[model samples]
Target: MLTLPSIYVLDICVFVFKNIDKFTRVEDTHNVNTRHKKRLCAPFSRTKTLSGSPYYMAVKIYNKLPNTFKTEKSPTLFQKKIKQYLIEKCFYSVKEYLEFCPK
Candidate 1:
């Protein structure tokens, strides 16, 4: 059975999905392993097939967030929750995260 906390978390999940586009933006960063190249982090390659952006990416990000952080809080909390979750998961502070770029 879903407890009170679980219910609240479900509500937050719904809110995040409802505001998916608002919270998630297309991030332009270096290609998978090529530091010299850059591209949008969407799955679709061609313009015609590209559905503005892919739903999977946003869903993927949301799913990675910890359940403890995903409370039925305000919309602004989404990004903050993600940051907190990441810090806990990776065991790093803001400065350390900024310095540790993937190779």
Candidate 2:
């Protein structure tokens, strides 16, 4: 069952964002800097493997989203845009997706 890692990441991000009350937002915490105010705060993961958990990964990927995408208010539109962007860019790996620099 081959599938795109980016799509999995996208779905995770959307789910997390939709259920934002379950997660900590940077703005809701005092520890995070103001620059990260719009992002979600990832929980501390002591082990490298633990950092790969869906919750952690979702925060990581969501925080990496372009500001334009992050600011989108409509879930449907955001999902559509991200899906199209993912398909067009065709990221080969999670690392590649993380390191992406949109121009």
Candidate 3:
């Protein structure tokens, strides 16, 4: 039951990543080349509460996803993968989900 929110948040992240083009890749906005270029650029936040805004939370969660999950091109496959992953992990909170390190 608790995992439902994590699954829902993951779905929202997937939607923003696949459908919304406003979020820029880390590589696009920076000059110093980094190996992890696929990450989304997290917007600046004035406070911790502001950092939890939908846009910021979406990027944070999306960035933490496995590379394979992030690269999935098909919406159905992405949803399937995320749902399977969340069910297996059974994350109870957004913070726990954020700190997950998939094996």
Candidate 4:
């Protein structure tokens, strides 16, 4: 799939899964009952084409972002920064991004 070349999309998400706190500020929340308050995550579209894939959604979202969010820091830092940037823009992690994108 074309998305394979653009692995950053999956990398960014995997990073988010590995380090969810960095994105949600779960540490900052004051909730006592729940452990964390998840942000407004969007599920990957389920259409027939690549347009429904998380790769497509991620690329589309990244392309639309401003330069301010396009920092070239370390891979770890870059992921964290991108997470914050996306959250600020109201773009959440893929709610149900399966292991592979369907055709």
TM-score of each: 0.32, 0.83, 0.84, 0.33
lDDT string, candidate 2, 1-103, tens digits: 2147877867976887588788888788786567768778889867898798877888888887778877788889888878877887787888888889442
RMSD (CA, angstroms), candidate 1 = 13.3
- Per-model lDDT: 0.43, 0.78, 0.77, 0.44
Candidate order, TM-score descending: 3, 2, 4, 1
lDDT of 3 by residue, 3-94 (tens): 66776676776787576588888888887788787788889877898696888888878887888887888888887888778878888888
Which 10-residue window in model 4 sums to the lowest lDDT? Answer: 94-103
Q: What local lDDT does model 2 show for residue 77?
A: 87
* Global Cα lDDT for candidate 2: 0.78
Segments in model 4 whose C-alpha atoms lie over 4 Å from true places: 1-48, 86-103
Pairs that collide in candidate 2 are none
C-alpha-based local distance difference test score of model 4: 0.44
Q: Which has the better lDDT: candidate 1, or candidate 2?
A: 2
**In terms of TM-score, which candidate is strongest?**
3
TM-score-wise, the better of 3 and 4 is 3
Please identify which of the two predictions, 1 or 3, would achieve the higher lDDT against the true structure.
Answer: 3
lDDT of 4 by residue, 30-75 (tens): 5545432333133445666867665455544443334444435465
Lowest summed lDDT window (length 10), candidate 1: 35-44
Number of backbone clashes in candidate 4: 0
